[model samples]
Target: MVDKGGYRMASGEAIEKVYYDGQKATKALQALENIWVKRDLILREPKELNLSRPSNREAVMMTIVGTAAPTECKSCTKKDGPFDGCFVVPGVARGSCNNCHWNSEGIKCSFRPPSANVDDTPAPRKPTTTALFKKKAAATAMTATAAQDATTTPAQAVTMTPAPAAANVTVGNFEVLPLILPPSMTNAQKRLLIQTFQNMIIVLENSLTDMV
Candidate 1:
C-alpha cells in the first residue's frame, strides 16, 4: 500500500494507521477510565477501521475509469465497435456493432470465433477508366465488323424525262420565212387584228353577263 506522501507501507501497517486515527481520542479516554477504576495501569484495546470501503467519488471514478473512447471495427479498420470483449479498427468513429457474428450494415464482416481462419486479402477494386475504355472499344469494333459482314440489298435505279424528240423530220425543208406585208396591207392588218380581238372580248363579256 502507498500513503498520500508516496511512501510504501505494508498492508497491515496501512490498516493499523487508519484504525488508530479513527478512534484515537475515544480509546485514550476509555483507557484512562479503566486505569482509574482499577487503580492500575493497563494496555488499551486497538480500534479497528475498514479501510477497504471506498468513498462516493472513488466509486464514481471507478465506474467510468476505462471508458475514454469508442471502440473500432476489426474487419474494415474503421473505429466502431461494441463496449466489451471486442477488438476494433482504429480510424472510423461510428456505426455498427463489433461483437455480432454478422454485420447488417452491408459491411460483410463475419465476427468468427478465435479458431476460424481469417482471409487477409483486400476487397476487390473498381475497374480503372483505361481498362473500361479498352473493353468498350473492343466491343464496338467487333460489332462494326459483324455489321459490315452481314448481307445488304442494293438500291433500285430511277430515270426521268418529260417527252421524246419527233422522228422523220426533214431539216432542210423546215423553212423560217421573214414577214413582207404591202404598205397598204400593214395598216388594215393592224386595225383588223386589234379591233377584231377587242370586239370579240366585248361580245364574250356580254354573253357571260346574260347567262349570269
Candidate 2:
C-alpha cells in the first residue's frame, strides 16, 4: 500500500490520506463547484479539487476496488468532444476509467450517459375525477332503469303502435296482463268476440252453481 498525504485545498483544508496498490485505490476528491472544475479542466490542478468535506471523508473510507476500462467514459462523449475536464475527473459524473475507476464497497462506478437523469422511475399516474364521475353516473343510470322496469305496470311497460287498453287478471299470487286488441279489427269482429266471451262466462257461472 502506497500511503501518501500533502493533498490540501487553497482554503488550507487537508485532504484525507490516500492508499493505492497496483490494482486498486481510493477515489480522488471531486470539485465542490462545477464552475471551478470547468475552469481547472485544461490546466488541471490536482490539489484544487475539493479535499475537505463530510462527503469527501465518507468517500475516502469507501475503497475503489475494480479493474477499470477506458470505455467507461466513452458513452459520455459529446459532439464537441468528451466533456470539458472529464479526463481530470474520470469517474466524477459516470463510469470509472482505468485512471479513476473504483468500486466503493463493492459498488462499481458504472458509466451513465449525460442525458440520463438520476431518478429514472416514472411518476405515479393519478385517476381523473371526471372519468370516475362518468363511470359512477353510468352505473347510477343503469340501476335506475332496472328499478323502473321492476316497478312498472304492464300498461306503462309495453309500447304499442295501436291504441292500447289493459286489464289485469289475478290467479293466486300471479297477475296476468290481458291480450291487447288491435284497433284495426272491424266493429263486427269486435262484437262477435264480445258475444263469444259472454257466452263462455255464462256457461262457467252455471257450472259453478251446479257444484254449489
Candidate 3:
C-alpha cells in the first residue's frame, strides 16, 4: 500500500509480515553440512585422540597445535572441532596438508598435541618484597645452619651461643674502690698508708695535667 508522504507500506497489521533471510539460511545449512562431512570423516577414520565427549556446559576450547595456530584462520573459529584428524577443504588439500588452510608458515601434522582445557591449579604468584625477604632470610639461615653442621663435630655442637663482653670494668673519674688490704696489716698502718697514697695520687694527677 502507499503512504501519504509517497512512501511505500505493506498491508494492514493483520497480514503477519514474515521476513525471511534466504542467504543466512543457506549459509547455516552449508555450515551444518560441512560439520556433518567433518563428523563423517572423523567417524570413518581411526580415533587418534582419546578426548572425552564434552557437555554443553563444559564445551572445551580445543587448540590445534600441529598447525602454527588455527585461531588465526578466517574460516575456522574457536567453536570449530579440535579433532586430531585434519579437516581441510578437499579441493584445497586432499593428500598433502601443506596446502591446507590451517597451515601457518611451514608447520606440519600432529605427532602428539595437548588440549586447551582450563587448568584448575592457580598460577604461581610473583613474590612481594616481604615474601622475598623472608625467602632470602630463610635461605641464608638454612645455608648457615648447613655450613655449621658440616663444620661442627659432636663435641663442639653447641646450640646456645655465648654472650660477648659488653663494657670494660675500669676505674671511672674520681671513683674510689674498696681498700682491700692484707689481714696482717694493722688499722693504724692501713690509715697511715691510705693517707700517704691519697697524697701521692694528688701529686701524680696535678703533674699529668701540667704535662698535658
Candidate 4:
C-alpha cells in the first residue's frame, strides 16, 4: 500500500497519511518485541542468591537462630538468601536472620532484636530557640540561688539587730527616700524576688557583653 506507485488511484495526501501511520505501527510493534526479549534474557540469567526451602532442615535451623539473639559478641554466621528468608518486610516477618561474618564458634546471628519499648519511646527533642531560653533561665536560677546562699549566714542573722521602720528623714541636705514594699510580701518572698531580679540583670549584662 505504501509502494511508490501501489496506490496510483489514491490522492497524494491520503497515500502519505496511510504510509506514515503504517510506519508508526511497525515501530511500536518492534519496540514491544524488544521489551519482551530483554525480559526473557533477565529471567534466564542464573541467580547467585539461593534461599533454602522453608520446609528444609537448614531453613528451620536458620529461622531458630534468626529469631534468637546472639549468645556471644563479635562472632556471627553469614548467609545470603531470599528477602523472605531474613528480615521482616510487609506481609513477611522473616525472623532476625541477617548477613554477618562467621567464626569457629556456632552461627552467631548479627541481627539486633527490636527493642520492646521502641514504639513507646519518644524521639529526642531537637535544640531550638525555646531550648536555649530554658537553659538560660535555669542558669539564672542557679546563679540567684548561689548568690543568696553565699550572702546569707546564721552568724550574721544572730548578731544583726532590727533597724528602725523606714521613714523619710533628712541625711544632710537631701531627704532620705521612703522605702515602699507590698503589704502582703514576707521577708523570704522579698529576698527571693530581689535575688531573681539581680540574676536577670546579670544575665542581661552578660548577653550585652557577648554581643559587644
Candidate 5:
C-alpha cells in the first residue's frame, strides 16, 4: 500500500512501521515551522544557509521532514509528484476535476509552489530480447550490403609483359643500386642524377640503333 507520500514502501511490517513514524515526524515538524513563520519567531534570512552545517541543523531537519510528506491536491486528492527534491501542494479541489486536468477557479488555488531542491536518484534499467534482435539484424544487413558492393565492383587488373630472362635480370640489378646509394642526397641532387642517367641511356640506345 502507498504511504502518506503516495510512495509504495517495501512490503513488510518493519517498513510500514518506519513509514508511519516518518509520516508523524513529518507532520509535527511542519506544524512547528508553520507556527514559527506565522508568529515571526524565526526571521527569514538574507542568504540561505547550508543545511549540513551544525548551526542550521534544526531548520534543515524541519525542511526535510516537511518536504518529504506526501501532500494531496486539494482538488483531485492525488499526491503531487516530487520535483526538484521538494513536495508540491496540489491545486484546489473541484467537482469537475478529471484524471489529467485540474479545474480551479482562483489563480492562487490553481498554481503549485516551486519544488524543493533534492539529490537525483537513478532510474531502473530493463533488458529486452526484442531490442537485442533488432540491433543484431540491422548490423547483419549492413554487412551483407557492403559485401555485395565489394563483389559487384571489378578491380583494375594490372598486366605485365613477360620479358626475356636476360632483361628480367637487368631490372633486378638496377633495383639494388637505390639501396647501395648514400641516404643524405638532397631532392634536387637526386633529380639531376636521374636525368643524367636517362641521357646516358638514350645515347647508348642511339649508338646501338646506328650499328643495327
Candidate 6:
C-alpha cells in the first residue's frame, strides 16, 4: 500500500505517481507506450513493472505502473548486450531480452500484427430491376396469347395441320396454338365452342327436314 499523490490534472485526476517530479512520470509513460506498441517483441519496458510512491501529499504525483513480464528467460545470451529498453533484467518480470534466441515473446508478436480497419458482416443481394421486368414481360406475353385463343370464332379458328380430333386455333397472322381442353379450358373458350356446335346442329336439322 504505497500511498502517494501529485497535482491533479484539470479534470481532478491526480497523476498516478509523483516521481521526484514530472520528468520521471514522462519517462515511465513513454516507456509504457513503447511496450504497448511492441507486444511479444523486444519490449522497451515489461508489463509487470510497478512505479509507486509512499505518500500523496506532494503537489505532483506519479501513479505509473510498469508492464510486468512473467520472468526473465534463463537462456538469454544478451545479458551483456547494449543497454536498451529491449534489454531484460534477469529474474525480474518487467522489460524484455533483445536476443532473438532468448525472446519467445518476439516470435509470438510477429503473428499479432496491428490493423486500422475491419470489415463488417456481408449483406444479402437483391434482384435486379432489368431481370424482374424481363420475367414479367414473358409472363404477360403468354397471358396475351391465351386470351386471344379464348376469343377466336370457329370461322377464324382454322386448324392448319391435321390434328387427331380438334383443330388448332390461329388468329389473323400468328402461329396456330394447341386447343385447351374442357376441364382445364377457360369459361370464354368453352362457351364459344358450345355455341358453335349448337348453330351447326340447327342448320343441319333444318336442311334435312326441308329435303324430307
Q: What is the lDDT of every predicted structure here? A: 0.34, 0.38, 0.35, 0.36, 0.34, 0.36
> Per-residue lDDT for 1-212 in model 6, tens only?
11122121221222333333343344433443333222222222323222242211111111122222344343232342211222332222122333321222323222122331122123457769998999899999999988778777756864444333454544334434555444655668776875675566667667887999
Clash totals for all candidate models: 4, 0, 0, 0, 6, 26
Tell me the tens digit of each residue's lDDT in model 5 across 14-100: 222323333443342344334322111121223323323221323333223322224333532432222112222222111111111
Number of the predicted model whose TM-score against the real structure is largest: 2
Q: Model 1, 1-212: lDDT tens per residue?
A: 23332323343343334345453433322322222121111111222323342221111111122121243336434423211223222211122222222222313444333332243234588989999999999999999867755534346323433353222212233322323333444566755654555566667667887999
Better of 3 and 4 by lDDT: 4
Query: How do the predictions measure up, each by TM-score?
Result: 0.18, 0.24, 0.22, 0.23, 0.21, 0.19
Question: How many clashing residue pairs are found in candidate 6?
Answer: 26
Q: Which stretches of candidate 6 lie over 4 Å from their true place?
A: 1-64, 67-189, 200-212
Clashes of 4: 0
Q: What is the alpha-carbon lDDT of model 1 when measured against the actual structure?
A: 0.34
Model 3: lowest-lDDT 10 consecutive positions: 56-65
Error of 4 at 109 (Å): 8.3
**Residue 5 in candidate 3, Cα distance off native in Å:** 45
Model 6 scores a TM of 0.19
Q: Provide the global lDDT of candidate 4 against the true structure.
A: 0.36
| Model 1: worst 10 consecutive residues (lDDT sum) | 36-45
What is the per-residue lDDT of model 2 for residues 129-176, given as tens digits with 9 covering 90 to 100? 998899899999999989878867757785436565433444334444
Q: Compute the lDDT for candidate 6.
A: 0.36
- What value does the lDDT take at residue 35 in candidate 3? 30
Q: Model 4, range 76-178, lDDT digits (tens) per residue?
A: 2222432122311111122233222111111333443345224433458888999999999999999997876676794663343456333343333444356
lDDT of 3 by residue, 1-212 (tens): 22332222222211111112222222222332333211111211232322222111011111111223433332222222332233333222211232122222112223111231123234699999999999999999999989889877868886744443222212326645555565666778777766776777777778889999
For model 1, what is the alpha-carbon lDDT of residue 50? 30
- The candidate with the higher TM-score, 1 or 2, is 2
Better of 5 and 6 by TM-score: 5
Clashing pairs in 3: none
- Which parts of model 5 are misplaced by more than 4 Å? 1-64, 67-125, 150-212
Give the candidate order by descending TM-score: 2, 4, 3, 5, 6, 1
